[model samples]
Target chain A: MNQRNESVEMDNQLAEFSDRILNDEETARAEGLTGELADLEKTVLRLNAAASQEALNEAQSKRMLLRLKERMRREQEEKAPFWKRFFNPQFGFLVVAAALTLFLVVNAPAVVNPDLSGTATSKSGVYVAAGVLTLFMAAYWLMRKK
Target chain B: MQNNSPHQQEISDEVLIRRYLNGEVEVFDLLYYRHLPKVHKRVRYVIPPNDVEDVTQEVFIAAVKALPSFRGDAKFSTWLRTLTNHKVAEYYRKRSRKQEPQIAALTETLAHPDNLSFHSVEERIYLQRALMSLPENYREILLLRFAEGLQFNEIAEAGNRNLEATKSLFRRAVTALRHCLEE
Candidate 1:
């Protein structure tokens, strides 16, 4: 049990040492690398520093900012009322869905009841509802495709 | 609005975020430029070079959308790093769905040992290849610890693990990385 305890202590010490090196805290000199384990520690520090340097693309930054501005503008427009939102393609799905629903309802009476009465027969009502439902489903599918 | 001066650099990310939230939308432009290199580097570590820009952009977009929900519990960079990881994972998921074989091919290319160069370039390339071989969690822990410079507690919180477990994971990750380099 004493040996196991010693092993755990050693592991914790090494872990702490690594943490310090990663944080750039002062530690033992690199010349202390006399064993395989020390060599590994040195390698780890070097690798850590090596990974820290990354190149940035100035051109990509400009392009990304431009796209972000456009997206933010569209988002702002979407927050406006229905009429204002209509100008942005970002709300095209909602627009199409509303349009299709309106079209179905407006034309439903003509197709369902030729008599032009406000009330329709049960069979004709089912047909009208089915037609509206079909149009809605089609609109949904089209929006998803877009 | 181009403020890359030292004084601007002194402004905290949280303060910048607050300013952006409050009417100064141009402050977001500063935040974007400030964090762009970090975001790009983090995404490049996990994603393919070709897709890095798209994933980085997606991370920023998601960050902007979710900014209102950010309650200042963590540093802005840490939050952004977590978002970058999620975006990279999502990118992989989408790619895998579209073409499973492409992921396998990409991994094989990354792991090709013969591609190793010499000097610091060789070391960096070898480390990157080894990192690619590691499990996603292990890679993320190492990146958070070493590259992003997050403390153990911060890493634990970001990873949803306890402090002790995060330390242990970091140790194991270093060991795994060493072994991978040896291979």
Candidate 2:
């Protein structure tokens, strides 16, 4: 047989031998293995031995599950919608900053134009603050996308 | 009605996925526990011990994020296995970026195996090093047969190869492994 054909034949034999050894070990042993086939059988056995040792015990599994759940919870919180995330304690600073910005904008007319009309300035000031916040958010989003 | 009973082992993974999509989120825990052992085994085969848990967690976390998009074209187990492989690859990629070795050094002291004997841990690491040194296809075939516990025919189907080709690959992989161990 040519080299390729011989290699193919050996492969078929190895696969067959592996099936028999795994499915019916006693029968495979009774039939006896030799040559490269014997060496392949030993290799298969060694791989199996290594695999059998890789099981995660109950305690390990439980500990891993706990850690996984904790991480997933954190992940979920991080991926929460913007509005929902804004309520998180870590965003308290942002909330305060927003409130301060609103206050500054509401009182800016009184500071800049001491004789300016009161009610309309405050209302327009509120709109101005909202508009600035929207523009800031849009710019932030664009930057992130870029 | 979707059964949410914790003891309902007969419910299929697909069913749990459907229920999870239908807002029965708790069913995911069932899927997680059901597949954890096999997924953990596969990850353990390739990853270092200290990082195995982290990598396994990353696999499931990716699964969770991607679960909503899963179309059920393939079996959940198969999908999870693929995800685990991706996460392991990503782990190595990040490690490589950080200038870490691919696999732990052969002479590096191994952490004590949780339940394994000292000799077994050494043997396992030695075998792991040998496996790592193999070409990707060779390593993959061996892992499919051993770590994934796939039969030769099943591996052939999974890899989209003819039975003969798959067997031939298996032979070459084993021979290569033997050579690696001999060295």
Report the C-alpha lDDT of model 2 over B1-183, residue by residue, as the tens digit: 123465688888999999999999887878888888778778777776556778889999899889999999999998998899899889888877764543452223344345556676666666777887899889988887777778888999999998988998999999999888779
Error of 1 at B54 (Å): 1.3
Q: lDDT for model 1, on a 0 to 1 scale? A: 0.70
Show pairs that collide, candidate 2. Answer: none
Residue lDDT tens for model 1, B37-121: 7788776555554466778889998999999888899879878988987887687778778765334535544665353223444
Largest lDDT belongs to which candidate? 2
Candidate 1 wrongly placed segments (more than 4 Å): A1-54, A57-63, A74-82, A85-146, B5-7, B100-137, B150-169, B179-183
DockQ (model 1, Cα): 0.20
Number of clashes recorded per candidate: 0, 0
The local distance difference test score of each candidate is 0.70, 0.76
TM-score of 2: 0.67
Give per-residue CA lDDT, model 1, range A1-146, as digits (tens): 99866645644655677678866694454574575456557656755666554456577688888987788777877789988645545366556556657765776666667667555564466466567667766666765634
CAPRI quality band, candidate 1: incorrect
